[model samples]
Target: MPAPELAAVPGSQDPAPAETGTSRPTATSTGAPGGDAPLGFTGAGTGEVSSGSPDAAAVEEPAAPAEEAPPSTQDSPVGSEPAEGAPATREEVPTAAPTAPAATPAEPTATPAEPAGSAATTSEAAAPAESTAPADSAAPTDRAEPTDGAPSSEAAAPGEAAAPGEAAAASEAAAPTDGAAPTESPTPTPGPRPAPSPSPRPRPTPRRQVPTPAAVAPAAAAPSVVAPVDAHDAAEAAAWGRVDDDGTVYVREATGERVVGQYTGADTEEALGFYVRRFLDIQAQLALFEARLAQITPKEIDQTLATLTEALAEPAVVGNVDGLRERLEKLRSAAGERRKQAAAEREAARAQAVAERTVIVEKAEQIAEQDPARTQWKQSGQRLRDLLDEWKTAQRTGPRLDRPTEDKLWKRFSHARTAFDRHRRQYFSELDATQDQVKAAKEKLIARAESLSTSTEWGRTAATYRELMDEWKAAGRASRKDDDALWARFRAAQQKFFDARSAQNAEIDAEYGENLKAKLALLEQAEAILPVTDIKAAKAALRPIQDKWDEAGKVPRADVQRVEGRMRAVEQAVRDAEQAAWKRSNPETKARAEGAAAQLESAIAQLEEDLAKARNGGDAKQIADAEAALEARRTWLDQVQRAVHE
Candidate 1:
């Protein structure tokens, strides 16, 4: 009994009750009986106790009588003697407690106490040798714990440790003893069990040595005391159940398990909504990124570098990782080009503004430089006003300009306009005064011309009028009404003088009419002398006629030419007679006359000679007759003078 109890003690420091039996023999073969095995008293073997305990002889006493006849094959109690040449023994109890009673002697009354005691002693002596028999046998090494001496305190009750070895014994025991009472047995000595602390043990059973699926199935089907689960196990259990904070469950039928709900800071509904929103946001961002990538596809790497540079320049969030990276890459190439474009635009705008400002300043300066005294300045002033209006209108509608420049330009323009307006107004006012003076001067000149209109000295009055007219012209423009009235007055005065002088001349012409008739009668008497043949008589009569003509007054202005022509002819006859008488009386005059006649004859002869030469050359005969006539006249005059002298 002690040997079996001793074997019931677990050999290992903390032996699992379920694994104790299977591991015992091999553990014992390592040479230290019960040393290498689990120390649990739940499944101690008889041989193990005989080898481990010095008191095996005494402990085996009680089982000697019952097992005396089957000494060679019967299992021994705890605390038996060691056998020679036998394998070392383990302290694990067998799991054959239900079969133990059948292996015991059937008739306990028929057996003598001395023989039973001696049988127990002999069993103890043979325990070590019997323990090796199972190892040598070809049967499975794992066995059920013996009920005869199993430690009730160490091993689980019949329902516990329902592993294969123990379960088979239980089924066998249940078939015949269904209605029998479970016998009360002494509590076996306590043995060490595996650590009861739920902390994970580092040492694990080798996978190959672990129970096969078939072997573990029977154990799993049986009811047994389950070890308390650890936190990790509880988590795994929760995962299997698909339990979440929001109480949602998700099962996966294919896996025959539950899908764990993802851990979220909030409840299921809220978390789901958040995730949905996040997913949509991510999708939207991805779409935007794709669009941006397309826009920059020409130089993808450069575009990405540029984008990254831009992203780095600004504040950004962690969520913008992809965008930031792409942006920086884009910036690498695009930065210079963008800068150049921007700079060019800036410069162009600046130049345009400067050009506009220069035009404005130049216009204002031109206005300032204008001479206020000139009429052209007045036109310039008006033009400046127009320019100012244009400037103001442009300020309201033209291109954008810097405020300071606009203000400065406006100031210059306003100043120039103000000065011009003031000067123009002052000039016009002074000109009006000058015009008033000119108007007074013109009025005085008109009055002076009118005063001289009735003067009898015609030439002197006309000369004064002419001088006033000259003065009037020399005077500048007067007020429009005054100038017109003054000119009219001056013309009226000159008309009055001319009208009086014409009337006086008409009266004088009427007086000359009577004198004209007397002169005409005398002219008729003188014209009658033309038919008289006595030269002396005609000459004497012509002298009287000329005297009468001189004594007679002028003829009518219209008949003056007729009367004078008749008188001149009568006078010419008298002169011709006197000249003829002189010529006839003077020989020297006749001689000189003859001499001129001879020179004329000589000129005529020379002209005839030339004419004859021209006739041979087809010259005209008319030219020769003119030369002959001229010579004959000269001879006739010379002869008449000679006859008069003789």
Candidate 2:
């Protein structure tokens, strides 16, 4: 049906020859109805249809008159050539008629046939064009189906094209419409229109090129359309990416229509595990550093920091950079506090140590100035040791201190202790030597005194022994053991000498007893002569007794006084008798002699002359004879004096 209608339009004549740009005769050109008849047909091509000959034109002319004039009522479809005479025919047709379905013969080619019933009313007014043609021909068949019941559907096609030409067209038509039914078949084929299905055939249409900046502008300008990524997840992925074998994810600019980025979660579990382990490792390292910090003195801070830095650089730990950064902040805060405290502690410890050391040093100087042998270095050492013990114990239990300062103080304390010990030892050693000297001197004295104890030279030797005892008393004390023994020995020697002298004194007393008895008898004879009457006779008699008394050996001290008193009485009697006789023999001379002898006669006349003569002659018998003669002379002289005086 489509082939003959295409043949009926003069513009569709000789379709093959028109495609080839060659002229042919119209009568035999079966693709179109007339060749050069100029029937005002507006369709795809006029030049091709015009190439047919006159015979072909005569046979197809009547059919052309039927369809050509009707189709000429509508304007040309887009990209179709203008009919040579159709613009004038298009003007002759009333505007309302061209809009009517019957006015458009080419409606079947432009619209689908699904609603063919509506075309009957519109085509009735224009029924002559189809009636003049044969009922069974392809042209009438083509027109009858699309126009009979679906005339409104046919008019809808040309109405769409005319609507755009209207200046006052509805504003609703300007807006984009997604579900509007096809106003007319896409201006090419007229058969059953395929449903406007979404094509799966990949369009080879080249995409319109856009600049990178322009492509990115839409996303940048409309940030709300794009969701934000999780920061924590990003950080975790980044950290894991550092140590994991999988690559990392990061945002980049969009290129053309594609957004740029990476997918670090290629090995999600392993990368996450690596990140977790690195975090734990960082924590462990931080803990170790903290523990070490507790032990560190102020001086060791640099070394500790260096060690921590070295540990942090390990590949195992590098993955935990964020954790490291967090820990570093904490460590820095703690370190600052620790440093402040450590500095304060160090200052306190230094001050205390300096004061204590000053005291110790002063004590040491004092000890050094004193005599090592006599000084109380042991007591000083004990005090210093106690102080040192206190310091050491404080270091163990007290607040933290500087390590270097602690070491220096300990060294000084140890040195001081050594000095104290050295001095103490030297003192005791010298004291031992002094004691030995004293012991030796005492031992020598003891030996000398022990040897002298046996000497017995009475007076001279005893005097020498007394002198030795005095020397011993004056001597210094010996060592305790020797002093006691040596003193005992010296005392024993002196006691021995004194005991012998006492014995000799007793013997000398016994011999003096005999001498005392003989002297007593001689004294009795002298006392008998004291009462004699003659003085001259007594004088002569007492002279011999005095000599006897002198010649007698020493008497006992107890008897000597009594013996001398008796002799004095006897001598006085003899002198008195002699004085009486001389008075008788020479009266004038006797009176002068008596006066001169008054004070002397009593004591002088008591001496017994004979006994005294016997003592003087050293003859015991002679002393006895003199005593008898003196007694007789005293008797005779007393008689003569008495006779003369009468």
Candidate 3:
């Protein structure tokens, strides 16, 4: 069998001693005896790396001389035995360090001693075969030096002797592989042992290695271990992430599972809880965004979506990553729909605002169109102001209107107001002109009334006052402020004239009061001549009384009716008396009376004779006839006697 290969342990090197005229061995095969296997390492460098060290290619560059490192605990026996029954002394050596001095070929090579009990297991052939080789004969054989970080195959354990059969096989295998002889080492010559130097043993430097159970001995030290997960936590982890026994953490996604983090502390539950909380935070943000979709603008929501998408792209949290992506996509769609709806609402509001503003403008226009003469100016003006206020309010509270629409409405409103104001000014101007004319006419009438008010010519002045009042009535009304003052002055002047007339009439009434008594006395005298026995005397008396009544003239107005009525009655009586006297004095009337009286007297005398006859005869029929005749004659005779007496 060929010699077993020996590789240097990580952080350690076995150096070759330098010798004069020694040739370095050339390696026919750097590969392992078996076919080289692939080590499936994907991180920190190339393939085929040792478990304890990096690949040789990574450190092939020449390095500066380094301090020797302590021997690795990984080195093991290569020839299968240790030398001289003493444990080998292991010293630290650094890889790529400068060489130490080698033992001289003339003297025996000093090998590390071996443990006493271990040497007994060796084959007895190993000792004799090692003792046969001459040290000087070995000088011609090439010694293999490690180069290009290649491992040395023939290296043996310190103080270990090789197996004779394997040494022969190695020599046979090396014969044609290279034209060099087999290397030989001289057997050690037994001699008195030299005493070890009195140097204190070096203390072992603590080596860093994979922690074992003993490493947790410190009171404060704790081991890194994954906590046992409950069923609920296990389910949660199945949905969110997976925890490996080595504390590696993975997040599950649709694409596949991916390494996200690791748990370095003892508790795996806390580590998983931390990542779960991060997922909850992200979920909370998404829920809040969904709720406020209407409040935030489309542009703002789009920006938030972009930010969230980027944040979730390579999420820090452990959860259903594919589910989160689906949720975000739905949110984006919802936001898009909301943006479209918002746009529609804005358009509708703008249209409504325009319609409302138009209505206000039309109302103002209608108010302005009303004729100022017929319009209730106060109410109309107030309505216009209210319409303007309404317009301003709509602008403030309603949606924004397009500029052209707003401007057009404003123009109409302004024009209406301007027209209304112009009409109002014109109407007041005409009213003022009319008032001026009326005031002029009233002033002239007032002046004329004052001129006639104090005149004492009662009849003429009264007529002039009546004429002035008629003129005042014909004059149009002035403004109330001027009219009231002018009217007061005119009325006072007229009152003065009427008051003077009343006083004058009162004084005349007192003067005529005595005349009323004299006229009453004269009326009594005239009334006394009623039964006129002497016509000429009655006439003469009445003539004088009538003349005196005329002289009495005007009486007090209260007494005029009584006195004049009495005097009229007396005049009617006197006329009736004169008619009677005339009848008595008239020739025709007297003749008619004398003839009737004479006829009645003759009839009476005849009837008296007939009556005497009837009385002497005592015949009833004849006597009744004679008596009726006699009564009729007596009645006629009495009427004739009265007429004759008159």
Worst 10 residues of 3 by lDDT: 37-46
Whose TM-score is greatest here? 3
For candidate 3, the per-residue lDDT at 482 reads: 89
Q: So what's the TM-score on candidate 3? A: 0.43
* Candidate 2 lDDT tens digits, 188-291: 22223223326422121112211122332222122121112244644553444332232221111111111111112134432333223323434555677777
Error of 3 at 456 (Å): 3.9
Candidate 1 lDDT tens digits, 367-486: 776776654875686777677676666666666677787777777877776776787788779879988998889878878878888887887887888888788888988768777877
Query: TM-score, each model?
Result: 0.34, 0.29, 0.43
Local error of candidate 1 at residue 367 (angstroms): 4.9
Q: For model 1, what is the error of residue 341's alpha carbon versus the real structure, in angstroms, after optimal superposition?
A: 3.0
- Maximum-lDDT candidate: 3
Backbone clashes under 3 angstroms, per model: 66, 69, 12
Deviation (Å) of 594 in candidate 1: 9.0
Candidate 3 deviant stretches above 4 angstroms: 1-238, 243-250, 258-266, 292-313, 376-379, 457-478, 502-646
Sort every candidate by lDDT, greatest first.
3, 1, 2
